[model samples]
Target: MTSHQPPLWRRAVAEMLGTALLVCIVVGSGIAAQQLSPNDVGLQLLQNSTATVLGLTVLILMFGPVSGAHFNPVVSLADWLLGRRSRTGLTLAELGTYVVAQMVGGIGGSVLANAMFEVGTSISAKDRATAGTLLGEVVATAGLVLLIFSLAATRRGILAAPAVGAYIGAAYWFTSSTSFANPAVTVGRIFSDTFAGIAPSSVPGFVLAQLVGAAVGVGLLVLLFPAASRMADDVVVPHPSQKDGS
Candidate 1:
């Protein structure tokens, strides 16, 4: 750790807490949307997307300084990959812990949302894993990675809060899968049997698609911003991770 930098334990807590809150917002809002607009699926989506956009932006701003507000496995993985050459972002050991924390947070968040909505914690029956939806995951994840890294590479990481939120909001409307770009979020949804839930059978395909999309995002980053690695430490937000040299 460096001056003004938090310890690894604190960073881990931030990651878990942030991811948990993110999933909470997603699942909670989805449930609310369904109840508020029971007759209009489109209206429900609008409510969900709007809440997500605002909530995500606030979460990023709240946690960015601590852990970069990854809230997603792909984001953390990409950061590790990009920073390996420069030793700026997460190390291999840190990546492992971060991933574990995110997964735990995601599951906890899902359960919390279920409790809040008075819903049972059961496997979702919503079968969304179709060829088209899988393809949508690809598009959504690719765009997310591309956008996040692009902002950092261009030295506009300061805009990450609103920009990332806006992109996700738009993707919710544009993509077929409703833009569950984050693998943690994807898995979390499986625990809820609400409007935001996904069937366990569909998770593998969605996860696979997200991985492919992340690779595509990296490919595009390299092509469009060859020097993107220079900013790998700053994805989503510039944090002490890169500077702590962990």
Candidate 2:
């Protein structure tokens, strides 16, 4: 391991904490938006999207140095896939660990958000999955994957914080499904019945769509970048001062 690389366990912890805070922001903002703009759905969406945009950017910058700030499973998977070339991002084994950590963090974040809002871990009753939404998921996920991977692969990881946050915020308006691009976020939203929530029944479809979107994204990344070896390190938005010491 390189002297600058943080250990996998530490990275996983960062992922868990970062993801938990991220979901907290997403759900909490949605609840706040709904309350603040009770009569105007458009206003509520604007509020929610703005909060998410700002929150995501801050979170990435805050945690990127620790765990690449990869709170999404698909991103970690993509890292592993692309990392294979130069052995930069994540190794195959690290992929599973990251996914599991992200999932646990996502769910925990949802529950925490619910608790904060007096919802008490309720299952979301908002069954929003539809044919059109699935397509939106594909598009949203594909675009997200493409943007993130492209930046990292091109050694532009520093831009990922604002770039990713901006893309997601934009997707919230441009896409029909409001851009639940991450499967972890999709699953996490199931814990609340608020404006940001999705029904349990919709989980499978959304997850499937996200996976498909990720695949599409990977393909586009390969087509455009064509070289994963160009990545800067073995992680997305690689760590700061930490050294592997191994």
| Winning model by lDDT | 1
lDDT of 2 by residue, 179-216 (tens): 99898888889988899999999989999999899899
Candidate 2 weakest lDDT stretch, 10 residues: 234-243
Clashes of each: 0, 4
> Which stretches of candidate 2 lie above 4 Å from their native place?
232-235, 240-246
Measured with C-alpha atoms, the lDDT of residue 165 in candidate 2 is 93
lDDT of 2: 0.85
lDDT, candidate 1, 112-216, per-residue tens: 999999988999999998899999999999999999999999989989999999999999999999999998898889999989999999999999999999999
lDDT for each candidate structure:
0.89, 0.85
How well does each candidate superpose onto the true structure, as a TM-score? 0.96, 0.94
> Which clashing pairs does model 2 show?
3-243, 3-244, 88-234, 89-234
lDDT of 2 at 160: 89
Clashing pairs in 1: none
